[model samples]
Target: MVGVEVKGTTRLLGLIGDPIAQAKTPSVINPIFASRGADIACVPLQVPAADLQKIWAGLKATSNLIGFGITLPHKQMAIDLCDSLDPVAARVGAVNLVRRERDGSFRGYQFDGRGFVRGLQAKRITIKNRDVLMIGAGGAAVAMAFALIEAGAKSITVSNRTLEKAEALASVINGDFGRLVAKAGSPRPQTGQLIINATSLGLNETDALPLDPGLLHPGMTLAEVIAQPEITPLLSQAQARGIEIHSGIHMIKGQVDLIADHICELWS
Candidate 1:
């Protein structure tokens, strides 16, 4: 395992979010940089939602800063700050990774959806032709829904606490895909081969489980996007029922290399 050796000339990369203590990007990304002998260090910064613009301006002024990762409340907000967005980010309506151009302008790209798909593939779980039931209609959920459609999921049923938000996301997805790929549904886990908890419900120890654990069956696959507790309550229940589970750590690991390559390209 290689280690990060910082110096005056080491390049800077950051993971920004409000309440960023749960971020695990550095632990997953820094070692990749070290292994490749790249003189870059990834750090976490807690930037409040109110101060994002001010902080973004300061980040642009730092010549050594190559790029940064966005999380939580800022992913959608960061999209407006970028000069351009990759197709994935544009479709997802969020930006999880931003690359600084030679002229110091920023370009945003989204990896959440791709990361989740890749994580599923790593576990030999196929999304193609499968019915997916996604909980939460937030940025992460939207990204995953788009990715699932792109990956050839037969259909996606999006459920959220707010039915309007879920309906809105489904409309956007169906419009973009030119088909009935997504539809708004109730929070109850629908009958689907794949079930995803894209909500933050599992982040806190006392939070309610995203869905009724009893709904998880032996043949179903469950996945989550909360990385802090690798095995979230929803996941634990699914595991106990002999259901296949994919953790948020898998999503992070799956994207680490892709993100490293993108940032290294900008630096070079």
Candidate 2:
């Protein structure tokens, strides 16, 4: 890992979210910037939901602030603050990364889903024509659903504690694709070829597994979006069953280049 050296000319990039203590973006992103010999620094800023707008406005006023990242509750809220949204972000209605344009305007883009898909592809796991069962219908799930459809997934089933939210997410995807590409379903692992846990179920040690481990089979691929534990309980169980596993770290790693390229453009 390259050492981080801060100078007066170093560019500022931030990861903003409520309860940002657990964010790993800085750890993963700063190294990339250092390795590339770019004078860019990524830091985490804890901003409450009520303070987001004020904080965002203040950040934009800072001349040297090139870009930032949004996580959790902020992803959906950041959409309204952006001057423009990337096509994928507009369709997903969420933004994970924001770049300051040449005109000093902010452009929002969602990379969570794209990162997840790319991570799988990097590991030789194919999503095309595969049946996917995603547990959770929040911002991350929405992004992943659209990406899966875009990547040619045969079908996707969304399951969440609040069935209404799951239904709404499915509706959005179906509406966008003009086909029955997504649907709402229960938490029980179905016959899906790809099983994903996009919820915070595995964030805590005592949290229950998102799906029944007994239902996992050797031919299936299990994935999660929780990066903290690295090896989530769901993935651990899947591993014991000989099921292929994809951790949340891979998702973060996969998007590092995309995020770096976007932020670097400001300096270029």
Candidate 3:
């Protein structure tokens, strides 16, 4: 009786993604809301890349919907759709969470960066002065790379399938920090203290590993941005090879409190 009691007055939130069946945001963040005795519930909203614009309009017009979360393919696309962005979201050029204002406008925010750093820090996984090899150059990758540097990562090398995209992301991060901490390189992962798979490659059974498995060694810790399946092939392979691995679940856990406050406006 001391938990959330969803009723007519309960507000709703959603996690939107293309292949949403595996998302852990709802399960992870719901309990935090319940503990606060708030009448809020978050559900999954599966929308293909094509239908995102249409769904965004609908979610905005709906009542009792305070905000929603974004993941995967939509994080970058959702940026232009938002009326405004929080500082981090603007700086990272991605939006993972959006709050619907009373006047039918939406404000976007990015927690992926700080949440990621917190996730690793919570486990005593050292980030400071570490060299990071990040796969993919999409929205999430962009945020994490910046955060890694902020957390005192000595260097970050972005490696994407498309070499140009990786280079561009590195250029952006470096230009922002003005310290030349991030650079674009191949996915071969020649050198790094941490290896991050920030791509969608491991989301499917038939997907290939983001990097050369042979390149992975004991010196690097493999981390993921995918939450579902709990253990992706990348993590499994890395573990089998005597490498330390971190799952996307920690990223989910890392963002729970931030998500709660943003979506429910608990602090407001």
lDDT of 2 by residue, 202-239 (tens): 87789987888999877889998888789987898899
TM-score, one value per model: 0.95, 0.93, 0.95
Name the lDDT of candidate 3.
0.86
Q: lDDT for model 2, on a 0 to 1 scale?
A: 0.87
RMSD, each candidate, Å? 1.6, 1.8, 2.0
User: How would you encode candidate 1's per-residue C-alpha lDDT over 212-267 as one tens digit per residue?
Assistant: 89877777789888888899888988998899888988889889899999988867
Per residue, candidate 3 scores C-alpha lDDT tens digits across 197-245 of 9998888989988887888888779999887777999899889999888
lDDT values of the candidates? Answer: 0.87, 0.87, 0.86
List where candidate 1 sits over 4 angstroms from the true fold. Answer: none
**Alpha-carbon shift of residue 255 in model 3 (angstroms):** 0.9
Candidate 3 colliding pairs? none
In model 2, which runs have C-alpha deviations exceeding 4 angstroms? Answer: none
| Backbone collisions counted per model | 0, 0, 0
Better of 2 and 3 by lDDT: 2
